[model samples]
Target: MSSKRRVASGAVLAALAVAQGVLAAPGAAAEPDTAEAAPARIHEIQGTTRLSPLEGDRVRVDAVVTATRTFGSSRGFWIQDPRPDDDPRTSEGLFVFTGRTTPALTQGDVVTVEGTVAEYYPGDPATTAAQSTTELVKAHWTVTARGARVPEALALGPGTVPDALTASPGGSIEHAPLRPDEYALDFWEAHEGELVSVIDARLVSRSTDYNELYVTTKPQQNPSARGGTVYLGYDRPNTGILKIESLIPFSQRPFPKADTGDTLTGVTSGPVEYDSYGGYTLMASVLGEVKGNGLEREVTRAQLRGELAVATYNVENLSAVDGEEKFAALAEGVVSNLASPDILTLEEIQDDNGPKGAGDGVTSADETLRRFTEAIEAAGGPRYEWRQIDPQDGADGGQPGGNIRMGFLFNPERVRFVDREGVDATTPVAVERDRRGARLSVSPGRIDPQHPAWEDSRKPLVGEFVFKGRTVFVVANHFASKGGDQPVHGRFQPPARTSEQQRVQQATVVRDFVDDLLAVDRRANVVVAGDLNDFPFSPTLRELTRGGTLRSLMDTLPESERYSYVYEGNSQVLDHVLVSRGPRRVSYDVVHINAEFADQASDHDPQIVRFVPR
Candidate 1:
């Protein structure tokens, strides 16, 4: 809590000197001007004694860290003292010893810590009182420290747990997989509703969005299983599950709320769960005293003023080919043909090698998207950032040159590519024509399967965009074929007929994902659009549009202009734009653009949709 807890000493200077000799110029003399300067200010202590001299009451200590050592704690041994004393006797019972310091500390490192001077207390190991300190006990530790180091990591002192239970055998409980009895309370007054820290209590029950926070005075020793009190914490926003770790009362001491400073209150229900659909997170929860910040309010173009514009275009197989001008032409066509929407939803982008393949013939997912981005930027459009899952070359029925994929392109000026959600649907196997169609195995050269799920499947691309002063959700999907074979029904129809089954399944997943999102808040503005590979009369499309009043941009066209890809000799509208609600119907249109391009980059025509929200 004090600014003085950031000072460095001469030991740092000596260390830097030795470091320079080892890391800097070998034969040439080092220049003084090039040397780092010492900080003008020194770290100092800020102390305030509490009326109750308990173990976890944070104090202030302004001293230089001479050494760092890890010792056994109630949980297990971890990096403890940044600087340990040579005479353990003198250092013992100092009350105020350093716990964890971010940016780490080294020998002779100077730092000023403002935290509780913890003292060991006696207790039993069986009861909550014996297990650890109770919420009312005021034996919980509070810490806040700042220092200079290579890589900073938060540290916890012995006082992290109540002194009473910490000394008992099978001591302070490890808070991993949080126990039900170990709950936490966050104080947000200092941050004006921004949660500062928490007081760990016990959990009574759990729900989809919220949980009950209660104080535990004793531990429950299960003779049949590993023993410890149940703790509580969650990560989902909106639906509130208290994040115990996030609320650990480490820094922001002095209690953010004046009334809550020492008072131990209980909120019967609190936010606990956050459901993620597509790329958006829906946080749901119940609060005790504080009311909602209208977080459930829907974000739309009207709320975003005129800064947001909804644009969609179907880019036919934007795949890269080595030594072929078509690859460069394809990239150029995507940037040139499509209207630049603040957030552009693209369809039929090819992933030949991986997700984003090299246009130069090599199968590389990163290369394909990289070229597409470069082409967009080169075409006088805003910098284009995108998200896609690179599949292995020949995985599934991927494009020949690279892994042809579906994705979205956004102008960073309007929206920065924060992160993506969902898993990749692409496989990593080489081209192995097995009897059971094409079986996909993991490819060694493609993206390592060890990464997160989102990187594997290119099915759905999730991204965040800042518009109308609120975050808007964007999801791009390319459903499976509608006429594919349906082995599930024992119906040996054409590949096209069976394709509908996979399409329905994919749509169901999308619908369920969207339903989960709407459950958190009904007003969320979501757009599910792309070359569905299915027609309007199909059952899969009907299922997706059933509950939420889905609006199709293609419906606005004069039926003739709605088709995206022309098959056989028949011209039918396959591409579409589906919104949450069809407002005025007059406010949406599907522009037939690619039909006019003489080069006709790919077989599929790019469909454009413009929507004006009322």
Candidate 2:
């Protein structure tokens, strides 16, 4: 709505916009559907559903330019009808993608445009599917009038969105008639491309490095104690959570950089758009400043000298060559926040050269662990000795050369690692019993590395540790990531969890291994921990803790506090610690140090469990 507003779309939208049209002649890209080809108004083009009824049809329309991107990869302008459309179901605005070419007009400039209506699905095919934004691609326009008043932004508040997440159950809601009063998806669809604003909204999550953040209009929604809309269930995606994408470039007015529980002071206005990252987004023309709520990082109580404290952390692809600051901060979290757990299971420890940065086909993480352990010692923590079996070069799934794998770090002063030879990446750890009862055949060994469940994924690292003269079997895991799962708010209701099958397989392998330990000794001190990468409510967890051989530490916490990760705005658990029947008394914590903060060393929050072995 402002002439000075600049468009700063995300990399996903920017790339998709370039895919809309590259200007190989003005109308060269249009492949009009045989259904129709005629002049249409904004409402007619947008229709009354989630998708445009006239999509894929070439049409002509006249409207005023509301916003424009003169630079960047997504060079496009937003156009909207000044006149009223009485139907509350249809939007009055549309995006005109000009590809690499910048628009020649400013805000309030009326224009007549002809183009093919298209639906632009952001991100690549691999990204979780979500609602798409309707666009006018391969366009040509001419100025009809200048200095016309810009359309006023529609005010959105808590009352604007329906408490319901969607109207259709897991089916394509594209044909469903608009029920803006009953469903949030429909309400957002009704206002698609229309300039909208939310005043003084509460930030639900921390602002990303891109200066983007999610805010909630509903204060009473399923909120976390630390001021976040907890994604309690797949059906309970908070309707009030709105993603604010900065339209004003950082050079002009930077996006508010704040943590969760912060507030967006003043008006935040923008056009409603959809993307893969955050389903419904408000591309802001008017940016809001952040008022800090002072949500601080949490510090767990240090374990007693006699207690065995084990922690699991996914350092987020840490090989991490240029991560001096990151390494220091992570070490500080281990020392100050996590209280320097005796045994730490680190996931995503990349190879020596960082993510895809390695040459000579190196896969070992000697340098990576060396730097991380040194940092921990410098941060007033004990020298942590580490052990891990290196995976075959380029065998793991993460960034190609990253060779990400799970490793263990233990304080020799607090605990002693039981050494066993013949442990390699492919060698599976086995439970062997002799005169001294059950013990590991190979310490620092892998569990079923050659199993199909571990194909292209990090193998579970199994180790033996002795604390207070008691042997403890620790299985550290970094299961397959949730990369391919369809979003909960995707077009398909109850979006399919395609990535879950792999995690389930990995869980079965880990569960069976735990069962093997329990089989050899009925009361073995065993701890299973690491980045499970699945929620507590998932089938993967159900299968992993089957037979009750290992009980998840998350089950020990209150329902609201069972989270170690915050995704979008949902406070949920991905990392977990589970103990066997041998630990008579246990205390577990999902240390809230990183996941909710804007300044984070890792995307995941490390979780620790302390117990006295039998």
Candidate 3:
């Protein structure tokens, strides 16, 4: 079952318990006759890997405090049995919620907690928040003894850890534990809310804003040069990496700024909990210092001979207001990393004023392109000319006043732009037969601007170019963004991708235009390249290549090396370059300068392909 259904089920159990008069109001005194009731062992209260059999029963547990969260939404402390049971399937630890009131308890203090056994979901129960934690709520506590010995933490590493992060098909944790020794989800479920330790773990990714570290006990699989593991395909499971969630409510400024491959040693103790963002996170009580590994930056690819390079880059909402620093970095990426491509299709190029709410109809990107081109020349690269047509005021959807659109940059020394007259933002350009066989009516024009699919989205820009006495038709596209899509690890099992419907329609429009060109001349040199915003395996891309008129170059890449963007822990592809059958592809590569790094100039990694004209 999905996590949402399990939470709903727990809500029902809570209602039943309240109706039976088993649960009392907060701070309410227990039944007067129960003064002689014997305290229950922590393991008996936490019966199995799933729900507690004693849930809703008023029980008293005697144990020693292991960790405490004095503040934050989950103001509570963890108590574990000093002498644990022989069975490894049942945990001996539990979290006692004291609400906003602080309890006078310290680590290693022996205490007896009397409360109603209730399962609680951290945030709102109805939302995407996953599994409910078995917690003791609406209770009272008293110190039985002070400064007692704390329970020894269970050590976790390679052989003891499960191979796969999840066992379910869609990557959701199952409601109940399956084989605890086989899957990570099952093993974590068995030890829910228990104190555990991971020693000498390697940092696989940078710490998040919430001061959480993603570490692995073993070496990362498909390790990239920058220290992150490159997710080759969905065929294999994760490499037993886990997140260390911080309970420190104050500033995490003292936390180290370590890169990938760094080592973190010492005893890192925490109680495991299921979090919405990170699947199973350890709310740490004691975390170790990060030691850097002296990792260096990745270099650029070498330029190939007798090949014309074309690149696609999404300069995340570039405009004049961003100043020179961002532009200079982008120029270096384009020239050094991309090997000074002859034709560069740029996406997310904002208006002159940028995101500064200066209304639409601004229509001037001269200063923006000039600054970028100047930066390229300053970086010891060629001075390139740019071409674009501004969109109608507020017609394109992006950051409100930014008016972001797609455009092109080309080196005049290598290629020449073929310009035609009478084209505007609303004008829909078409292919026509001329003395030069098949050609665009107006070069650098919008494709099917009147189609409903192009509403509030970027329109495909078609441009005609001549390189080495051969005409090449290029289409620059920036499809609708993937907004409002459900997260991969959300409550919904096999989460819905609602944004794909609009992209399917957009793909059809672009494919029809390509078909019109192919009808005029069967073997026309056509190259479509840009930030497609859809994976090569998605249904939207399937529609584009349905008739086999255009083929995605991504198929030529090895399965392990076909990613241009990283989201969560998976490396995926959202940018593409498709070519007709006429051209000969020399090489293609997606540069890994950004995306995996914490200090990234842009969220996407640029892609370049070298091909020879027919």
lDDT per residue for candidate 2 within 191-305, as digits (tens), equals 7887888888888888877667889988888778788877666556678888888877677775667888899989988777876787788888778788998898999999987
- The TM-score of candidate 2 is 0.90
**Alpha carbon lDDT of each predicted model:** 0.36, 0.81, 0.74
Q: TM-scores of all models?
A: 0.40, 0.90, 0.80
Clashing pairs in 3: none
lDDT (Cα) of model 1: 0.36
Best first by TM-score, ranked:
2, 3, 1
Better of 1 and 3 by TM-score: 3
Q: Taking the tens digit of each residue's C-alpha lDDT, what string does model 1 give over 273-376?
A: 11111111111111223221111111122213354455555655655433345455545544554445667666666654433433444444566567777766
The positional error of residue 520 in candidate 1, measured at the CA in angstroms, is 1.2
lDDT of 3 by residue, 96-166 (tens): 88777665567865666778777776567566436667778766766655555565666777666776654
Q: List the residue pairs that clash in candidate 2.
A: 170-493
1 or 2: which has the higher lDDT? 2
* lDDT value, residue 471 of candidate 2: 86
Alpha-carbon runs more than 4 Å astray in model 1: 1-307, 322-337, 351-364, 392-396, 420-458, 482-496, 582-587, 596-598, 611-614
What would you estimate as the lDDT of candidate 3? Answer: 0.74
